[model samples]
Target: MSPQQKALILLEKQGNFKVGSRSIPTPGTGQLLVKVYSAALNPVDYKIQVDGIFVTHYPAVLGVDIAGIVEELGEGVENFREGDKVLAHGNFYMIDQGAFQQYTLAVATFTAKIPSSQSFDSAATVPLGVDTAVAGLYGKHLGAGITPPWAKIVNDHEPKKPIVILGGSSSVGSYTIQLARLSGFYPIITTASPSNEDLVKDYGATHFFDRHLSASQLMVAINKVTDSPIRIVYDAISLPETQSVGWGLLAQNGILVLTLPALVKEDEGKGRKAVHTIGSPHLPHNNQELFRSSWGMIEKWLLEGIIQPNNREILPNGLEGIIGGLERMRMEQVSGTKLVAHPQETK
Candidate 1:
C-alpha cells in the first residue's frame, strides 16, 4: 500500500475542518492501520476545535472513536490480523493520527477486537464512553465501594451504600449504572427526564428521579428510594447546579465523582468528598488494557442481551453530515440517543 491516504483535515486555528486527501500513514513498530468505516462525534471534537487545547498541528484529524477492519500491521504487532474487525479510541490528544478519515494508524494497545455481530456504527460508540467510565470509576479507586477490583476495600464495612448516577440517560451514565449494579451495590438510582425513566431503569437504575423536578421534590423522591441517603454520586452532567444537588444529596463522608471540573461552591456543613474525573479516553498510556477489559465485559452483556447500547440516531451522509448533525445536537440538546456518523454513506 502507498504511504498516502485521504483524511478529514482541521486546518489552522480557526476551527475550519474539511475532508481531503493526505498522506496514508504507515504502521510504525507496534502500530496498526485501520480502514475507517464509521466514527463517532464527541462533544470534545467541537470543543477542541473551538478551544484548540490539544491541536498541535495544522490539518489535524479530530475523531477519537473508530470502528473498522485492520488493513495492515506494523512490526512486532501481535493479537491482530489484517482482516480483523476492530474498534479503537484513536489518539485524541496525539496530533499525528485520528479516526475521521478513510484510514488511520493507532498504537496496538489502544485497540480492541470488535464482536462480529456488532455493527461498525455501534462499535464506534463504545471505546470513548466505555474507557471514560472505566478509567474514572476504576482509576484512582473512585468506584472503590462497588466491585471486585475495589471490593476488598469496602468489605467488612457496616453497610453497603447506594450510588446516585446523574444524567443516567447519557451513554456513560447508562454504562455506569450497569457496572455499579454488577458490582453488587444495592439500589443504583439515577436522575433523568421522565421520558427516559423506563429506559434508565432497564439499564439497572433501581429508581429514577425526574431531573426537571424541584430540588425539594427530587430530594423527596430520592429519599423515598433509600433511607440512608446517597453515599456515592456520579455526576455525568457536571454543571454547577447539578453538582450542588449531588453534593447536597450525598451522605457524610460520601464522595462525588464528576465528569467535568466541579464549579459549585462546597457547602461548609457537608463533610462530603469531591472528586473531579477526567474520563478514560483522555488518559495517556494503559489505553489498550482499559479498552479491552471494559469492552470485554460490555460485549458479554451485549451478547446475552442483558444490556443494550444507548439509542442512536444515524447520520447516513458520512463526513459532510457531521456539521449539520453537530449543529442539531447543539440546538436540540440531544438527550438519550447518541448521534452517529456512518462515513461510508453512499453519496
Candidate 2:
C-alpha cells in the first residue's frame, strides 16, 4: 500500500472541510513531491466551500499557497532537487496538486526556491498573491501591458509614473505596491485603514490614504500627491464602492485591474477599460514564459529584501486549525496577515 497522509477535504459541493487520510501522491514528469510545512489560508478557500466555484470534483482538497521541502524529484525536473526548501503555486483542481495535504505535487515551472531569509510560514504567503500581482501588472494580453522588470527588450526602468492601489493591505495590493516600486513607479499611492498606512508604506507605498475616505475625498488626496494622470489602478478589493473610486481615478486609456469580476461599466466613448484577471498559472494561455521570467528572480529578490511576504499569523492545531482560520477569513476578521497551518504538525 502507498503511504498515506492527512488532508482537509470538502466531501461534497458546498460542504464542510473535514480532515481525512489520502495516499501521498507520486510526482509526475517535471514535478516535485513536496512535504508541506506551511499552508496559507486565502479568502477564496472559504468562498469555494460556500459558493462551490473552482473545484469541480467532489471530495476536493483545496489550497493554493504552499511552502515546503521537496522530498522527491520526477523525471527531467532540473530546477529543484530533493530536500530543497521551496514555495509553489498549488493547483486546486487536482487532488494530488492541492496544498491542503501533508505531501503534494508541485509543477516545476510554478515553483521557486525559498531563500534563507524567510521562514516556511512567510514563504507560504507568497505564491497566489505574488502571481496575481505580477500577472495583473505585467501580463500583456491579460493585464495592463506594462513592461515587466525582467522583460528582455531593453524595457524602460524609470517611467516615473504614479499608481493607485486600493486595499493596499490586501495580499495582492501589498505585492503590487512592492512590484510597482521595483518597476520604478513613483508616488505609489494606496488606500488602507490608517492603521495599515505604515504597513503599506513599508511595502513601498509612497502615499497612503484611509480606505474609509469618501470617493471625492480620496480623489482630492490623490490629486495632492501627484498631478500625473493615474494610468494604472490595481483595485485589489474591487467592491462596488472601491471600483467606483478606481474608475474615477483612472486616466484615458488607463487600465483598472480587478481580482473579481468587474461591476463598473465603461463609458461608451471612454478609452478606459476594466480587466478582470484569472491569475492561476495552470490555466490555458497563462503565459508560462512570463511566469518563468519572474519566478527565476524570486530568490534574489527575497535575499535582497526586494520582496517581502505578508505578515504571518500561524494558526494553532496543525492541519485541523485551517478550518477556524478559513472561518476567520470569511468573517473578515483577518487583516494584514496571512494565516498559515502546519500539516506536518497534525496529530
Candidate 3:
C-alpha cells in the first residue's frame, strides 16, 4: 500500500462525483485508519450528491457505511489494532473520514469487529441499517415495554404492548420487525406490497397488510388479527398517506416514531405522541454511549445469525458507477434492496 491512494471524491458545488487521488489519512486520536474493502450506498447518498445537505467541504467522499481491515490505530485506541477486521459507520458529516475511499478513518465507538463468518459486502450493509433501527426502536422508547416471554418468566413480569412497523419490506423496516419481535412484543403487524408478505412474516412480522389497501381496509385487517391496537408505531416510510393510515391505527396510549418529518400537524387532543428521529449531534454526552450500544447489539445479532443482511446488488464500475446507480435508484424505486461499491476497482 502507498502513503497516498486514489479515492472517489464528490467535488463541492459539482453535480457529479469523480475519481481522484489524495493522501491517505493517518488516524487521529481514538480513530482507526481502515483499508476499506467494501462500501454500501444508501438513498441518503444520492440526496446528498444532489442537494448537498450535510457536506461541509468540496471533493468529499460520500459513503457512510463500510467494512474492512484496520491498517493503523491512533494513540489511545485499545479495542482495535493493525489487521483487525471491522465494520464501521463512518461519520458522513465529517469532512475527512467518509467511507467511499480506499482508506478511511473511523472513531472507535462507531465501529465494531466484523463477525468472521460474514463477508465484507454483507458486513458493510449492517451498520447504517442497524443504527437507524436501534435508534428508532429504543432511543425513542418505542418497544421498551415489550419483553420476551423467556425474560418475563425469568424475571416474573408481564410483556410490553405491541408495536406496528410500516413499510416492512424496506431494509430498515425489515430490521425493525425483527428487533420488535426480539423484544417480546406480540402481534408485530406491518404494511407492504403483497409480494413481500411472506418475506416480512419470515422476519417476525406476525401479520402483514397490503400498502395498496384502502385505509379502512387496512384498519379492518389489523383489527381482525389483534384486539389490542398498536401501542408504538415506527413509520419507516413516513409519507403523508402512510402516516394517515398509521395514526388511524394507533391505540390511545400509543406513540408514533418517524424516520422523516411528519408533514401533518399532530393533534395534541388525540393523545398520541409523534416525534421524528434526528441525526445525533456531537456535543451530547449520551450520544457516544447510544451509538456504541447500537453497534454492540448489531454485532451480537450478526454473530448469532438472528438478523441477516438485506439483499444487495453490486455496482461494478466503482467510482464511475455512482451516477448510473443514483439515477437508477431514483427512477426505479429500489425497495428492499441495498447497493454496494468497491473503490479499489476504480483505480
Highest-TM-score candidate: 2
Candidate 2 vs candidate 3, lDDT winner: 2
Candidates in order, TM-scores: namely: 0.88, 0.97, 0.90
Encode model 3's per-residue lDDT on 1-347: one tens digit a residue.
74777777787854677788888988889899998888888777887887778676776787778899999999999988799999998766765578788889988778888888898888888777766777676663432233332233433265545778999988788888887777767788888888888888988898888888877897788778878767788888888988887787777767777877777565657677766764332325334556666665667788998888877888897766756777788675676777888877774
**Which lDDT tens digits does candidate 2 get at residues 36-71?**
999998888998999989889988899999999999
**Residue 68 in candidate 2, Cα distance off native in Å:** 0.8
lDDT of 1 by residue, 184-248 (tens): 56778889999999999988888888887765777788778778767788888877888888877
Models sorted by TM-score, best on top: 2, 3, 1
Better of 1 and 3 by TM-score: 3
Better-scoring candidate (lDDT), 1 or 2 = 2
Score each candidate by Cα lDDT. Answer: 0.73, 0.91, 0.76
